[model samples]
Target: MPHLTIVANIKANADKVDLVKSELLKLIDPTVAEPGCVQYDLHQDNDDPAHFLFYENWESRELWQMHSNSNHVKALAAATEDAIEELSIYEMTKVH
Candidate 1:
């Protein structure tokens, strides 16, 4: 497993920013503790309100896939479908 960070840029700044932010917070604990996941965090950019970053640390790529297939993940996606313009995921490992 490695560390994963996902950044998503929303399509449009919406009225539900607070709601979406809350939803993201709700998913953090469960997602981080999920199999293979070491940590999961959500970040908001004050300079760009439409930009969100998800910081995730996983045990392995395989387990990450399992999380991606989870129901909550789906719900998150569905909840933000209209707001997302693009999504990017980065994989990294500690060298130190």
Candidate 2:
């Protein structure tokens, strides 16, 4: 199976930036330790503090799908339902 890359762009409510960050940060350790997870790093926009990004590389599409529906991920989704302003997921494969 080919490697998969995921770029997740998340925007936090301006007034809930801190709360959002705390919630997202909680997933890092577990996500990184999951099987097939090559890299899972989180980033905050330099100019726009409320904007966040997740750079993740997985071994395959199946593994990524599993990760997406994992307990922790589901918990995060429920926990931050109202705190998130925008959530976009991009799944890609390298061409070159």
Candidate 3:
């Protein structure tokens, strides 16, 4: 089976960029240590500090789902509830 790839785009509220970023940063360490996690990387747009993106690879969609429902992820959601302007997540498999 093909590995799962996740592309998450996050846009922070104008005044909450720093808070959102810090909360997002908290996910990396724990997520990387989760089962089936192959890669977990986070990035901020060079021209737009309020924009952030996450590139992730998982061994399977099921395992990724587990990670998604973990406590840490939930905390992130709660912490940034009102601080985020937009959030988009795309689940895909590599074609090449």
Q: Identify the leading candidate in terms of lDDT.
A: 3
**Model 3 lDDT per residue over 1-96, tens place:** 889999999999999999999999999999999999999999999999999999999999999999999999999999999999999999999999
Pick by TM-score: 1 or 3, better one: 3
Clashes of 1: 3
Q: Which run of 10 residues does model 3 get worst, by summed lDDT?
A: 1-10
lDDT of candidates 1 onward, in order: 0.70, 0.94, 0.97
What digit string (tens of lDDT, one per residue) describes model 2 on residues 1-96?
568999999999999899889999999998999999999999999999999999999999989999999999999999898999999999999787
What does the lDDT come to for candidate 1?
A: 0.70
Summed backbone clashes in each candidate are 3, 0, 0
Model with the higher lDDT, candidate 1 or 3: 3
Q: Which residue segments of model 1 deviate by more than 4 Å? A: 1-16
Q: What does candidate 1's lDDT look like per residue over 1-96, in tens digits?
A: 335544334323466677577667778777867877777767888887766787767777788888889989899888877666556776667766
Candidate 1 versus truth, CA RMSD in Å, comes to 2.6
Which has the higher lDDT value, candidate number 2 or candidate number 3?
Answer: 3
Error of 1 at 10 (Å): 6.0
Off by over 4 Å in 3: none
Candidate 2 Cα deviation (angstroms), residue 94: 1.5
| Estimated TM-score for each candidate | 0.76, 0.95, 0.98
The order by descending TM-score is 3, 2, 1
Candidate 2: C-alpha lDDT? 0.94
